[model samples]
Each structure stands twice: as C-alpha cells, then as structure tokens.
Target: MIPVQRVPVSDRTQVLLTRWTGRVRDAGGTPKAAREQWIKAQTPRKHVRTALESMTRGAVRCMYCDDSRGTDIDHFQPLENAPLRAFEWSNHLLACSYCNSNAKRSQYPVNGDGVCLLVDPCAEDPADHLRLLLKSGLYDPVDKSARGEETIRVFGLNRPDLVKGRQDAFFRACSNMRDWHRLHQDADPLADRLAQALLDSPFIDVVHAMTRLKPVAEATVVGPATIPALAAWRTAHSLSFRVGQPRVRRSAASTDCIDGVADNALASDARSGQVRTGRRNNDEPVISMQNYGLTWTDITGTPRSSAVAYDESSAQDRKADLVNDGCTNVEIVAVRPGKLPEPRG
Candidate 1:
C-alpha cells in the first residue's frame, strides 16, 4: 500500500466530524450504539467520502489490496473497538467491498501489549513492513514482527486473484519502465504520457515495489537503467510544478534546454531558480537525475525527508497493449533494507 497524504478537511466538514464524535462521547453509549449512529450519520456526508477517495493512492483503488475500486470509507481502527474515534479523519481509509465487507470486517488484531499488528500503509509505508516480491507477487515479511503477516491475512493480500493482479502490475510496470527509458533517453515527449499510465494503473504497489526492490527488478524485469530513468523523470516532473509552470531546474550542474525552451530568462527567474533549457544532449544535453535532496514535513509535523540514492513511477504509452493481465507471488529471503521497530512478538 502507498503512503497517504491526508488533506485537511474543510472547516465545516471538520466541525461535522467533531460533532459526530462528540455525540458518541456525550451519549456514554455502547460501542454498538456509536457504530449505529455512525452508520446513520456518515451516509449523508458526501464531502467526507469525497475527501477520503481523493487521498487514496493509485486511481482510487482499495488501499488494502490495490486490485478493485475502493467503494467504502473504512475505519482503520474499527468503530466496534474504538467508538470515540468513529469520526476521526485519520481513522478513515478507502477500501473495496471485498476487503472491507468480507475479508477484514471489524477484525483488528493486536499484540498482547495492545499494539496494533495491522499494517496501516496510510500511517506508514508498507514497504517498511512488507516487501512485495515482483517476481511471484507475494509479500516478504520484513521483520520478525507479526504485523506484516497479519496484514496480509486480514486483507487477503495473497488471494489468487489479487496475486495475479499484482503479478500483472509488475510486468506491466517493467515494460512501461523500459518504454519510458527509451522515450526519455531520446527526449521523446510521450515519456510523460507513459509515466501517467503507470501512475494511473491499478495496483500501484507494483510501481513502489520497483523502487523498493531496485536490484531484483533491474536484473529480472527491465534493465539496469529503469530506476535511474524513473528517478530523473520523477524529479523533473515534481520540480516542474515548483517553478510555476513545467520547466527543468538549471543548476550549475545542468547545461542544456527542455525540448527547445531557451536558456536565458528574467533575472528574477535566476534568483528564484533555473528556468528550462537543460534537456540532455541526446536531443537535449545530458543532465544527472540523481541527488535533488528532496525534503518534506511528515504527518507528525516532523521532518525526516533525506537525500537517497533512488526514489519513485514508470510505464509505456500503450503502444500495443504492453501489459497483459497475469497472477503470481513468491518469497525472496533477502536482507531487510533498514532497521525497524523491535518486534513485540
């Protein structure tokens, strides 16, 4: 599952949520009564529903399986368990019917110490807990913690159909990455279209999987160049918006043009940052896509963003149905990437 960026609800909506929570708090009702009230009050709040859907990753697919359309606003912390948290914005997640109604329901498993065993990708990157094997499409538990295993069981993450979908997504991502690399190397404009295709595709876990499992995907799916090319594209794509309109940043390290945008611009542009004119010499001048030193404020109002060797998306322009549906899951016994919290169990 992808990391969700929770957008602040409108003041009016926030007030509505707060009022609902207040009702449960003041009623001194059983969790059942709170849940009943919640079911009644939640349906009319289309605004809340809209906000939840907008924030979920990858074409609004179920934040759990990433296979089907997300139709339910799931309480990550079940209402039956935490009635007072019923209307909390942070407690909500987008989910598909099968995952919400059938697979998970209200079952929330926790360790004996009462820490949740469920992996909430909205709260943290699932990659840190579970590594999705691109080859067979099964998840590899990262630590001794039961959270990874429990999350998979709760969500039916390894169900045959879902496994097939993830497998399909992986190969599709690889082909698209290859296509993107080719287009990008030649400065082909269609590279942007392909990037969108991958981003918009179902099962975005596959895209993130490519980044997290860099060496494996490189040797098996595409080639050595996939991640670097995608890294450059993502950098350029994100930085494009930062400079007002889409223009490449021309650091001292950069020396070229974007497509054909001119090198010189207003002095204010220079003071602010580079304005276009740094395309690689292939069609533009070759520029390193590495090390933009990205930083951002995490949800807890803490800053943990760091400069890393690699980061995140890619795909083809649907030239000829480059990706066909397929199913798979396998375990790769490899060393975990980083240190995790000590497992409770």
Candidate 2:
C-alpha cells in the first residue's frame, strides 16, 4: 500500500471530536453500544467522514485495498479494542465496506507482548515490512516482520479479484502514461484526460511502483514506450528532477527503497505483450509448515487466509502426511532462511 497523506479537519470539527471522544470514552453501555451509536450519528459527526474522504487517493478509494470507493470510517484501533481512541482524529481511517466489515471487522490482533500486528498505513509505510510483487500481483514480506504477514492475512490482500484488478490496472496505467506523454504538448485536453484517467484508476500503487522502476530494469521489463511517460509521472509526483531542479544521483540503496524493496529485475510471464516481458523465476505452488509472506490459498484453491504448516520432516514425509490427511495435491514448501515467521512478541 502507498503511504497515506492525512489532512487536518476544520477547527470546529476538531472541537466536536474532542467533546465526542470524551463522551464515548465515558459512555457505559453493552460492549460496543456506544461505538455503534457514534458510528450512526448524523449532525456534527458526519463532518468526520467528509474530512476523511478528502484525504483518500483516486476517487476516494479504500486506504487498505486502494481499489473500491471508501464508504466507512474504519477505526485504525478497533473501537471495541481500544475505546479511548474511539473519536480520536488520528485513530480513524477511510475504508471500503468489504475491508472494514468483511475483511477486518473488529478483529485487531496483537502479539504476545501486546504489540498491534496490523500495519497502520497513516502512521507508517507498509513497504517497510511488505513488498508487493507487481508482476505476481501478490505481497511478500521485505524481511521477517510478522506485521506484514498479519496485515496481509487480515486484509485478504491476495484474493483473486483484487489481484486481477492490480494486474489489469498495471497495464492500463502504463498505457495512460504513454498516451499522456505523446499528446501533452499539442493536445492539452486529451493529455489532461489521459493523466486524470491514470490518477482516478484503482491500484494507484501499481502505477507508483512502475514509475519507481530503475532505468535499466524498466527498459528490460516495461517496454520502452512508457519510459518517457514514467519520467513525466515521476516529475509530477516530485519524485524526479524537473527542468530547473538539480539532478540528484541516487545510489542503489535509495533507489531500491523508493517503494519498499530496492528496484530490481523481477520476471513477468511470456503471455505479456510489449507492455512488459520477462521469464518468470518462481511461479509454482508452495505450502509451508510455518506462516510465510507468500500468500496461501485455502482448500478451495481461492486466495484467502493464513498459511498452514505441515510436519517439519523431510519434504516427502510432509507430502505423505498431507496426502494421508486427504490433501493429495499438496507440496511442502520450506521457509527459507531469513524468511522465518517473526516470533510472537
């Protein structure tokens, strides 16, 4: 997920929030009764939602999935779990209904040490722990941070429809950038439309990720057509040097860390057209005996929940045990070194 830039609420709204926060924190009711009441309120409180939507990217999309239009104010810290922050401005987030109610709901997991497991997009960059593989349209942990795995599992980030949405948006964003670059000078209106289309589309992170690709890597993976467009896009975002700005040469360290991991060559499939092309390195199915940053599908074969662990025996032995337990198609995937699950706090 891209880092969220939060804007401040009006002074009047801020006062109202202060008063509301006190009431909610002091309210004595059944479990989350006070929170539900606060959520359903109209006057004064409605301003909170309007203010949040303005902070969202691309047609007010969900901050979590960054796809669907946001329709709910998700409490970053669940209202039930951390009631003190119930009406606190910094504790609320813009979210889609599916992500708020279905994907996450009131489930806020913490490690043994009581550290919150879910990544707070507003407070920290998710890329610090997780990296989205643009080609695979799946997320992998940058290191062995449990927060990344927990966030992915909590959001069901690798579900099929979302992955396909990212995959489709990836190509469409490039095409939009290319079109905008070609017509920018001569056809102002059409160029503006092209740029707006790219901005309004879902999976904006995909566009941002593409623009951050290193020069040589971009040439090898993304076709040459989008190079200039990528440059313009980067300039617009203040990520690249403009005409008057001094050129700042970035080392490999800074360049790669632009999004999450360093920008490098990762493979794309042969089915790709001139838009992008590469021979994929790892595309096989894998299952682990411990949680992995690589997403795992459920028994129905749909991308969904937490990873499963088999016996820590030999690969054949693990496969045999899974088969004996009625998982005939299963294959054992060992957790590589430096990729182990983060120990619970």
Candidate 3:
C-alpha cells in the first residue's frame, strides 16, 4: 500500500457529512443504524466516494492491496466500535471489495494501550513496518511487532493475484533501474527516461522498497542518514531530487515525505536545534494520461504536474495514445527523493 495524501474536502461536502454525523449521534443508535442512514443518503455518499477516489489519482486503486480498483469506502476505525467517527473524513479509506468484505470485515484489533494494530496507510509509513520480498512478491513485517504483519493478514496482501502484480512491478522496476545504471556512465538521456519509468511503475511501493526511497509524505524536509545511497546518487548526477525547499522551522510532530525528494533541502528541527546538511530539492515531474483534465495538488500546493521512455519514438507512442484518448496536455516534471527521518534525541 502506498501513502496517499488526504486532500481537503469541499465545504459543501463537509457540511453534509457533519449533518449526517450529527443525526447519527442525536439518535444514539448503533453503528448499524448509522451505516443504514449513511447508505440511504445519496448525495453525501456520492461526495464521499468522489473525494476518496481523488486521493487515488482517479484510478481508485484499493488502499490496502494497491492492486484492484477500490469499490468500497472502508472505515479505518470500524464504525461498529468507533460509532462517533461514522462520518469522519480521516476515518474513511478506499478499499477493494475483497480486502474489505472478504478479509477485514469488522476485524479491528487493538494493542495493550488501545492503539490500533492495523497500519493506517495515510497516518503511518507502511515501509517502516513492511518489506517486500522481490523474488516472491510477498510482504513481510520488518519486525515481529510491526503492524504490517497484521495488516497483511487482515487485508490479504499476499494473495496469489496481488503477489503476481507486485512481482511484475518488482521486475519492471529492477529492469528500469539496471537500464538507468548502465546508461549512467555514458551520460545517456535513456538514464533519465528510466528514472521516470521507475517513478510511475505500478505497485510503486515495491519500486520504492527496491530503491530505498520513501514515498510521498506530509512534510518536505528529509535527512541524509535516511537515504545515504540515494543521496550519493543524486550528488554524482548533480540532480536535485527534493519537492520544495522551504526554510521554515521544523516541528517535532512532522514526518518525512513518503515520496522521495532530493537531499539536504529540508528545514532543521527546532526542537533538536541542529542544522541538517544541505541538498537540492527537485519537485515531482508528472506524465499524465487522463480522460478528463488534470486537476490535482502537489506537495507545494502547486497546480499541475513520466515513465521510462528516454527515446523519442517510445515517448511519442505513449503521448499518441493519450491524445487519442482525449488527453489535451502532456507535461513531464522532475521527481524528488525522500527517506524516513531519524528518531529525535
């Protein structure tokens, strides 16, 4: 599962959700009743689904498996126990029917502190808790107590079909990385193409794990110790790989970017009072092929926007397909690197 940015919902939608939650609360009914009321409301349901789909880049891939198209709105906290959060936006996640109905039906387990055992992809980094075995395309928990083990079991992440998909992604990513490395010494344009291809590869999480890069995150700053290899590559290539290099005071609560960014562009943590090293921040460059117009926000809240196609012929073929499908614009942007932050002292 990849990290998804929770975009802001419209005021109209927020108001509708609030009204429904208030109704459920006023009735003091069971979660079943709350769900029944929510299901009956056509407008609010549509708005919520749309907002969740947007988080998935219109592909609506399941937040759990990252393989199938998401067909249900999953409650990160089951509405059965957390009834009051029935309509809470943060509690909602896009999920495929198999992961939702077949595997994780009302199975909300908590640890000793009442903290959830499941990994909320939006709230935590799945990579920290999970690792991908490239050969088998199976997910294993990074540690015994890691939440990924439970998440994988609960979500059926290692099911045969999902494993196959991850396997394909892993092979593609490895091939592209090798190609990039081969062209590196030659200063070949194909190397750049290979990098973009890796960025847009399916099962992006696998690609990230193989490359040791973090996915996108809530914050832009990253530390050198987090991604030493990637930092070294960026330095050798003289490429800036960060999203944005804002110099604001860092807070203790912030997390590193999930998507990779260039080194040293992050602000220093005021709590730690250390001047982190300096590196360039290269924002993500996008290559979109959508039926509708591209409308999405970036880490910098900038409007607008790749794959491995370094040659003109292959690039043209992809662009042609987009144009035939009614895509009007074709823009290519740079990508940044990111790594998990070190624990604060």
Candidate 4:
C-alpha cells in the first residue's frame, strides 16, 4: 500500500454529501442501511465515485493492494459501528471488490488501547509499518506491534496474485532504471521516456529501491562512473524518486526556482542600465515588467530553472517548453518585477 494525499472536494459535492447523510439520519436507519439505500441512487453515487477517482489522480487503484482498479468505496470505520462518520470524506477510501468484500468485509479490529489495528494509508506512511521483501515479493510487518501485520492479514496484501504482481513490477522497474542510466546522456529522449514509464508504473516502492540499491553497475554496458552520475541524476530529480506516494504538487507561488537564468539576466540588465522605473501619476498603475520562470527537479536532486518570461502566460509557455523537453514536476513561479523571497543561504 502507498500513501495517498487527500484532495479538496468541491463545495457542491460537499453539500450533496451532507444532504444525503441528513436524509439517512431522518430515516432513522443504521448507517450501513443508509449507505445501501443511497448507493443505489445514480446521481449522487456517480458524483462520489468521480470525486474519488479525481483524488486518486485517475489511477483509481485499490488503496489496500495498489494492484487492482478500485471498484468500490470502503468505509475505513465500519458503517455498522461508526454511523455518525458514515459519510465523512476522510472515512471513505477506494478499494477493489476483492479487498473490500472478500478480504476486509466489515472487520474493524482494535488493539488493547482501543486504537484501530488497520493502517490508514492516508494518515500514516505504510513504509513505517510494513517492509517489502524484494526476494519473495511479500510484505512483512516492521515489528510485532506494527499494525502492518493486521492490515496485511485483513486486506490479504500478501496473497499469491499480489505477491506475483509486485515481483513483476520490481523487475520491470529495475530494468528500466538500468536502461535510463545507460542512455540518459547519449540518448536523452529515450531515457526521459524510460523515466516517465518508471514514474507512472504501479508499486513505486520497487522503483525507489532500485535507485537506492544502485545496482546498475551489474549491467554489462555500464562503466565505473555510472553510479555517481546516476546518483546525481536521482538527487536532481528527487520528486521522481518518491516511492509509495504521489509526486508532490506545490502551488506555483510555493515552488522552488531551480535555475537562476532569469534572476541573473535581470541583474545583468540592471547593471547595464537597461531597467527604468517612473510614475506618470500618483494613481497610475505600475507597468513594471514581471518575469516568470519554470522550475523543476530532474531524476537526480538537481534544481532546474528556465529563462524568464515577461508574463504569467509566458511562464506557462516556458513550463510547456520544459514539458516538451521531457521534464516532470514542473511549476511556473514569478521570478522578477516582484521577486519572490529567496531562501536564506
């Protein structure tokens, strides 16, 4: 299982959910009964499903297995017991029918302290509680008290099919990383394609392991310096190396400026007496030229920045340019006219 970040739901959807729950309360039925009743309603049901799909970034893979498509919405706390939270957004998670109906059907066990035994993938990092056995393609609890054991047993995470799938994903990711290392410089286009494939592949934990293990030296075509270059690339593109979670998407204002080309250019212009400022009237709107730059990390932990643009649209254009150049985790931020605060050295 991987960690999933929750996306904000639209107010319209929130109102619909609130109204549905209110109707359930008015009927005086159990939460489970209410769920059954409401799920049969086509419009609201579709809205909830569409919202869930968007939250999962359109992959809509089962939160428990990450292997199968999520076909149903599973209540984190069983509706029979926690009726009040039945329609709570935080309590709903996408699950495959197998994991929902067959494996974890209404089983909500608690520990001695009354803490729930199941791992909440959204609230907790699964890697902290579970460790993947690369050789066996099986999941094991990090320790005896870790909730991973109960989660795996309840969700059937180590089932034969899942184990086999994980193994295949692991091998495929390793092979691709090796190819990426070999062709990154001479055949960059192909390498970028391989990088994107690795990014989009299921079971990203396996891909992250490949980067950490640095096993590309075993490839017959690799050289002594390949490991360092690979490491550098990985550092530059830390966003791509993230395992067990979706890539972090920062707002344009919060994104880091990688290259200083725009800043340096503006500084050079100022030094060369190219910049001029004047106010025609007290209330005249300032027409200062603002520059925006596209910034993103590569596979390695290096910061990359683009040339400055005169407007936000130009910044978006620069972002597209980076995308066309095979960049991932790209963002456009204002770099000049109104310079963003710089990080303390």
Candidate 5:
C-alpha cells in the first residue's frame, strides 16, 4: 500500500478550519450557510490551493487512475448532499484532476444491508472489498453491494487508461519481486532476508501485493520456509498520504463518477497483452482476505453486529439507517484501530 503521511497544518490554515467547522454547524442545513462557506473557503484561494499541495506531497499518482500525479482536493464525502460534513478535516482527500473530474464525482454507495462502498481512508481498509484488476487496471468490488457498485461507478475504476495503468504497475512490481527472489534462492536468516526484500521496494503496496502473490506452499524467498509473516497494513499508514481542500458536489449531470463498466475490464484477454515475462512459479489460486478495519464482521449467517470503533448501540442504529437508505449490507470499518502498528524492522 502507498503510505499516507499527514501534513502539519499551518497556524493560518488551522485557524481557518476551526472557524469553518463552527460556521458549518451553525448553518445546519441552511442553503445560505452552505453558499457562504464555499465563498469564504474559495476567496483567499491560497488556503485551498496550499492545502492541495500539502496533501499530494510524496503522493505517487492518482489513487484511482494511478497514471498521472493527483493534484486536487477530493471530497471524501460529496459536499453537496452532506454539507454538514463539509469541512471535516478527515473528509478532504487529494486526487488527480482526471479522477476528481472524470471519474469520482460525489458518488458513494449504500447497500440494502447498509454497507457503504465509499471508502473512508480513515475508516475502511480498501483491500478488503476492492481489488485492482492486474490485467484490466479497473478496481473491482468483489462483493455485490451498493457500496461496491457506487464506488466503482464514481471512481471510474473501469476506465481503460486507469485499469491499464494499474495493470502495468502490478506487473512492474511483480517482475521486480520475482527477480529478487530468483537471485536469493539459497539465502538464509529468513526474517532478515524477508525484511531486506521488502526494503528493496520503496512502495509497500507493491510488497503487500507481491506477498499475496507468492507461492503459498513455498518456503522463504530462497528456501522452503517463507519469510516472516507480514501483517495486513493499510495504504493510509504510508508516509506519502495527505489531505487537500474541500470540494462541492455539483449536480449529477455534472458528475464525473458515472455508472457502467469501462472499456478496460471488458476488453478481451488477448487484447490487453499477457503478464510481463518472468518465472511465475505458482498458477495456484491465492485468496485475498479483507482487512475491514477491525470493525467489520461476517453477518451472512449470523445477525449479530460488532462495534468497530464507536459505541455499539449507536453503530447498530447507524447501520440500520444506512441499510434503510438502500445499503444491502452494513460493515462499519473502524476509523481508528486503537493503536496503529509501528513500522516493522
């Protein structure tokens, strides 16, 4: 996962946000307050502009497209419909203009079961429900929930260019890992070796993906024993992650995050080209486990709900409400997983 690093806010920005928060609360569903907030936030320009710059620092590329560098502030929650959450610090995300405009426009999903596919960088572990199509480049939602469909639609996951980019990245990363493994076929000190192997790549997401792809029955990178087990880590933990200015959601007609599969995913396998050349040891199917931010539970057969972060009673009530709104399943990903794991040695 690409790590996310938070930029320390300047006193000027902090002061502005503090006041903005209060103003939004006071406005509380008033059209006038919402308009006033947008005007004030945009007037100086520097506040929003600088915030976008700060958030994209160390950012790899568009989180959705993974092609061009992301350069704008994205509203994690579409601001038009949920103005109350307009200025929340955690709600703003840095994104590329293509993704900001062409792909993800305020489209978030709610399932009949109350599962929201709109990933909260603060709450959800993206790897859980979503998977990047290595060949297709589109981000596919494995579960058939409203959240999944909406997120895919809004993010333009199936865009030809975007999916192709992700597919290229996957192969590039995979090729590097495979080459390293071939070189150290007889290495020792399993844990030390695994650590070094991981350190070789600056991109941890690549490492996680490689780990998931490694031959399951094989040993360490070199021997019969595999390297020490690496726990699931979120892309948000990366030092590269950042925040940006708030966005106002325009009408759905102007929405960039639209429905329908992009041409990439639908492309015939032969048309996309085969996986990059290398000795891919295993054709064995590898199963990916979802890291639901500790707050998620399997309720397929059971009716019990588990609290991931907030109070149990409130969480259930919220889940029910989300379900009522058309979310078929509700999985409350914990925003804060208590203490984050320290960087591994």
Candidate 6:
C-alpha cells in the first residue's frame, strides 16, 4: 500500500469547511451560505479524487483484502477518537466505506517500534507485514511488530465471514487466472490477456497475494487439477503443475502531489472552526469497485472524470455485485512501499 498524502489547503479555509459534516449534505444542499460553503470546501475534491483514482489504475487493488475498487476516503487514524486531527488533511484517505466503518473503526494501537497495527490503507504494505492462512482463511502476522497484531485485532481478520470472503475471493481469482491461461496459452497477446485478467478481478487482493509464494512463475500459471481440459492444455506444452498464485508487484512509494495542498486546506478549515474538510478541490468520496467496477473506462474510457455522478446504473451495478460475491462489510488498510509480495513471472 502507498502512503496517501493530504492535499494542501490554507489553514483558514479548512476551518470554514468543517461546518458541513452533517451525515447528509451534497454540493448543493441547504441555505445559500451553506451551499456556497459546500462548493468552496469541494475545491480540492478533484485533486484528491484524481490522486486516489490514479492509485488504482491498471487493475491495482486494495492493500488489505480483495477490494479492487479502492473507493472511500479513509482516515489513516480513527476519526472518532482523534478529533483534533479529524479534519487534518493527512489523516484522510480514499478507501471503501466497508473498510472505514465495519472492519476498522478507531482500532489503531501502537507498539514499541511506533508502527501502528491497524492496516493503514494509505500507509503500510499489507502483504509484507502479514500473511494469510489459505486453508483456514485467516490472516497471520508476518512479524512480531505491534502494527501487525493491531491490524488483525481491529479488522476482525479472524471473523468467520471475513476470512471466508477472502478465501472465496482467492478461489475465484485463481479460477479466473487459470481460465485465462487455458484460453490463451498459445496466444501471443500475453499482455492483453493479462490486462483483461486483471480487470476481471477489479478488487482482487488474493490473486495479488499469491504471486509471492516460492516457485511462483510456474505455479501461478499452472493449475493443480488433472482434469481432462487442463491436462490436455498442459500436455501440449509440457507445463508443470502447482497451486496458482497472485501477481504481486514490488512496492514503490506513490508520488504525492496532493499532500502539501491537503495539509494547508485542512489547517485552514480547522482554524476557521469548520467541522470538516472543505471542497477547495473537486475531490469526492471514494466509492467502492464492488459498488462501481474497477475502471471508469467502462463509462468514460479512462480515469479522468470531469464530474461525479450517482446515477441509477451505478447504483444497480453495485447492488448486484455486492449481492453476488462482494463484501458489504468494508474496511480500509494502508499499504506502503516494500509491503507488497514479489510478482510472479
């Protein structure tokens, strides 16, 4: 996971923006002054939203679980207890709401190393710090670090449903990759196939995780089954067999052009006694892929968006997928450079 930076804003402006934190409010909801306030607060929305959308570009996924959508503004720390920093630009994130409320709600506890256990969707690499129990469907701490344990305890990693969801995602993602291999083993368009496969699992974290296991290159591409269809395909190429893995990549710190601006914006709002961050930029709330698929390409052909909309199609799409296989219980986990597993060849 990459460390998310707060977009900059002047201290005064941020304070003026926080007054619109009510559970219900939009760019145009309320008294003339309130409406104007909302619009001003949203000035930074575009920058913040753009930064987040860029992170998930090209099939990138959630750092913690299999949420490929990477939607929602996450607080690196809990907003409830950390009130002073609640509107702090650095404290905010773009994450799935499920992750923000259900899996982790103010559950950050620290250890001696000063590393937080909560899986910060914007701060730590989840894979480097933790491992998953494939058979039992549980997440295990890769080290004795305080941050790892806190992540597990806070997110309910051991929760039967959550673990089950991870396991199910793992199985489906493996199946999808295997299917891709079967269909295109001899096809020369490897990159295209790979891209499509990645898109298939917009929120697939399991596939991302498995790519790190030893003997990854062959293992991930070759399925364990000896079924006729699989056997025939492998026999033609003399392929080796093994359990499939995810395609993990070496972690790198994301460029944070939005940080300084975010901090200044938050400070300004806070000083003005604003209850929340303002829309100084056009940044919008991060919605989930489960709710909105992986790419805007399906609708707009790319990541850049001129505006945000909550149309019927978007709503229906989210509901169906959630009912089918997505998790409604979302949580955000921060990932940092050096936290991801090695990618399989």
Greater TM-score among 1 and 5 belongs to 1
Ranking by TM-score: 1, 2, 4, 3, 5, 6
Question: What local lDDT score does residue 188 receive in model 5, on the 0 to 100 scale?
Answer: 19
Per-residue CA lDDT of candidate 3, range 157-242, in tens?
89898899888876565555555656643534355456654555457666545445443520122223333334323323221122
Residue-level error in angstroms, candidate 1, position 293: 18
lDDT of 4 by residue, 1-345 (tens): 766544334334444455556667776758666777566545556655665565442256787888778999888888787765565556778899999999999999898898999987766667778877765688889876458889989999999998998899866655666677676545243554466556556666554444444364333323344455546345433222122232222112111211222445445544564322221113222222334445675545455654222244445654564566566777766553213323221
After TM-score superposition, the amount by which residue 27's alpha carbon in candidate 6 deviates from its true location, in angstroms, is 22
Q: Per-residue alpha-carbon lDDT of model 1 for 1-345, expressed as tens digits?
A: 655544444333444555566678877856886777787784324656776665554467788888789899898889789888787766778899999999999999999999999987655667667878777888767875589888888988989998888888877777787787787566443664577567667987777666655554565654665667556544433311011122222222122332132344333344443222322113332212221222233233433222121212111211111212111111111111121112111
Q: How close is candidate 2 to the true structure, as a TM-score?
A: 0.65
Please state every model's RMSD to the true fold in angstroms.
Answer: 18.7, 23.8, 15.9, 16.0, 20.6, 15.6
Angstrom error of the Cα, residue 125, model 1: value is 1.3
Candidate 4's C-alpha runs over 4 A off are 57-59, 208-345
Among these predictions, the greatest TM-score belongs to 1
How many residue pairs clash in model 6? 73
Selected candidate, larger TM-score, 1 vs 6: 1
Model 6 over residues 1-345: C-alpha lDDT tens digits?
Answer: 222222233333333324343321443333443324434545344444444454453343443444535565555665444433333454556655566567775566776786565765443356656676554567788876555677777756577766777677666655655564554433322423453445435334444445444443334433455133333322222211111112122112222323344555555555655533323223433122111112111221222210111122433443343234323322122222112112111
How does candidate 3 score on lDDT?
0.55
Q: By lDDT, rank the candidates, best first.
A: 2, 4, 1, 3, 5, 6
- Report the lDDT tens digits of candidate 2 across residue range 175-234: 777877777534232454466567667997787678667787887756888787777655
For all candidates in order, the CA lDDT equals 0.58, 0.59, 0.55, 0.58, 0.43, 0.42
Candidate 1: count the clashes: 19
